[model samples]
Target: MIAPAQGGLRVTAVDSLAAGEGIVPGLPIADARALLPYLAVREADPCADAEALARLAGWCGRYSPLVALDGADGLLLDITGCAHLFGGEDILLADLTRRLTGFGLTLRAALADTPAAAWAWAHAGPGGVLPVGVARQALAPLPVAALRLPDGMAAALGRLGLRRIGDLMDLPRAPLTARFGDAVARRLDLVLGRASEPIAPLHQPAPFRRQLAFAEPIGTRGDIDRALEHLLDGLLVDLDQAGQGLRRCEFSVFTVDGGVQRIGIGTARPSRERRHVLRLFAERLEEIDPGFGIEVMTLEAPVAEILPAQQAALEGGPATGEAELARLVDRLQQRLGRHAVVRLEPVDSHIPERAVTLVPALAPPSHRPWMVEQPRPLRLLPSPELIEVTAMVPDDPPLTFRWRTVLHRVAQTEGPERLSPEWWRDRPGTRLRDYYWVEDLEGRRYWLYREGAYGEPRAPRWYMHGLF
Candidate 1:
């Protein structure tokens, strides 16, 4: 690939065929074409390259969630606790190299005690596992460029006959700082493990997670379900020992083709019931599109809560009411949506419309109790509808009313109970309401309210608020 450079279009990259012909990056495209009469070339797209690199980094999540972008052309994976899953560091690196090579990518990989050392090894030294305490030795022969100094720093060092990392190692720190600033010393310290260099991962690894790798890619639903069950078996044991349960969890399918399918579920309450949790996941398992078959499956609990052990029935009877209700809600949410299953909780407000709010089914009960002293209808309308009414007097209960194009005549009346707007919450000019419990001639009862009072500049407007 070629891109516009300082003087002219230059070779930004080359294929193995062109690389054999002495073509390298930074060589002018004119000179490259002269070297090879028919060299196939394409413009280098840095943006597209960066995006593809980011996607590759995302795919690396299967190996470890702590994956970071090293540079435009590289990825950094913190496989501290993840290598064992692929057998060992040797096997893991081999697997990674093989897979990427199969994808038509020319790449190199190395592992060391520090990211800087690993980078140097992969870019300059022999690429493989560099044992602990050998970073200083392994990095010695590598060129000064491996230290990742500012542009021109490496060429400047070479001009002074200091071309290797080992030359700088024996130099006085004060002189080096006075000559090249602290960049040289800082990078050296980082590579030799003298300073800590933390990798900022794309996503933080969850504390509660389990991963299962398949020797051969598996695409069948039964195989996927079995894998999930096995993972949950181990994950739940950890949660049980910790006296905790997960409220939200995710199941990720890492396909062999570098695609990921995720199925997530949330519980109405913190739960560790194996069967109950599995059933919830089963509802959404069909959504998994195992692209060229899945090679890895991971279960992660991003949200968890403390759930103390509960006493069980001696006869091993059915679950308790709360548990059963919670399971029902979980099932509904899994099939429908997280917001589909909810309960009404009372709010600390006097306005009928603001008296209650919708909350998740398992949300903690509100401290404020319901207004039972003042009778409320079994159901309430989302918003009161306006109605036309005829009253014996301006402030008296409605004698007749028309709602939804239907008319009703009042037979019995019980109220004109006045409720004022909350001064702190309601806007100015917000009027008080007079509510009435009236039974229509057909014994159909209705809750009605008047927005304004009598003798006001504008007459009161009646609204049908709820049904009895």
Candidate 2:
């Protein structure tokens, strides 16, 4: 049971046992308990349910690349050009229903030319295929709720003797529009196929993918490698003909025990070279375990980019060194995790802590140049470390300081560079900072700061901000 907006608990869902005892979704909890005293109930988890639905949608990709969530519980698959591959629409629907049912799911599926019509038929009629031109005939007997209108709107239609969809089909549009507004007419058109409804797939369909199903299951590592190489050969042909390069590829192995293991690899630059892609996957292929033997292999390039034709140099010189460097970076990232490889890029900020940031190694370098007028440190602390300092009363470089339990005597020093907090984002306790560069007697350079004005109610404090 889940709490409803009416301030009391209601049955959001029911199990087969509860349904058989005359309890259904939306019944009051008190009334349900009266029917069955020992009914088991628990609060619903919408987030977990949504995540499971998304995973189910991904799994449905084995049927069609275009699969979308219709509602929290339903799915929409656009199998326009894909029906022929699985025999026909009826066979495909049956196969989907049988497979999902095997996973302990109760499913209702219907096919029509429009999403609205299919949705209505799936909810109201016995699941079956509705031919292209028979949407009106198929939807005539369903209730007004099949049109997917607001609860208030459907109730209003019911009170006006418009119980069946066919009742509203022949009614004058102006009266319906005047009473219920345009939503009534719009939904009617959508259900009857006069208006078009498009399904937005959960994931964009990949441009290139190759799959191979073996006649017999093979668990050996050599067999898996051979299958992968075969799939890659077909995938590369498609990429080459389209003048494109693979940016990322996923290799999936489906085992006979109904489990899938996937290995994904990415590149620093777009590539179509077979040896390079295979080499990247070779490092991680051992991680895949072919439980109960592997039956099918699929290689898909979900990310790709255009690669314009290249011309050979007049002297047939060697390839660009930058390409080799990018390949090396890719290999290192593959061996190490992605976060293990990064590049430091300068950020456009005057504050010392916000001057530069870490970015992905393959990311394009920032076009802006670094500020060189002021001498900045080679390394900046994640946050300034507090310190005790003795200096002149007014604003002068520190004469002596103690940081991290160690005292340092100043040998040479620079001026106090004043920087105030951005006033547009003014907040309480925000204040100006005075930064100074100083060298200790041992030649260790340090960047220090004094927070706030010296004579404020709260005395200014010192901090060591960076090291050079």
**lDDT for each residue of candidate 1 in 1-468, tens digit (9 for 90 to 100):** 999999999999998889999999999999999999899999999999999998888778888989999888999999998889899999999999988888778898999889999999999988989988878877999999999999999999899999999999999899889999999999999888899899988777777998888989999989998999999998898888888899989899889988777888999789888888999998889899987899998899988899887664443367778878988999999998878888889877778778888999888877666876577777688889999999887777888999999999999988877899899988999888999998998999889999989888987899888898
Worst 10 residues of 1 by lDDT: 310-319
RMSD of every candidate to native, in Å, equals 4.8, 4.4
Per-candidate Cα lDDT values, in order, are 0.89, 0.85
Compared with the true structure, the alpha-carbon lDDT of candidate 2 equals 0.85
Cα deviation of 218, candidate 2, in Å:
6.5
Pick out the ten consecutive residues of candidate 2 with the lowest summed lDDT. 309-318
Structure candidate 1, residue pairs in collision: none
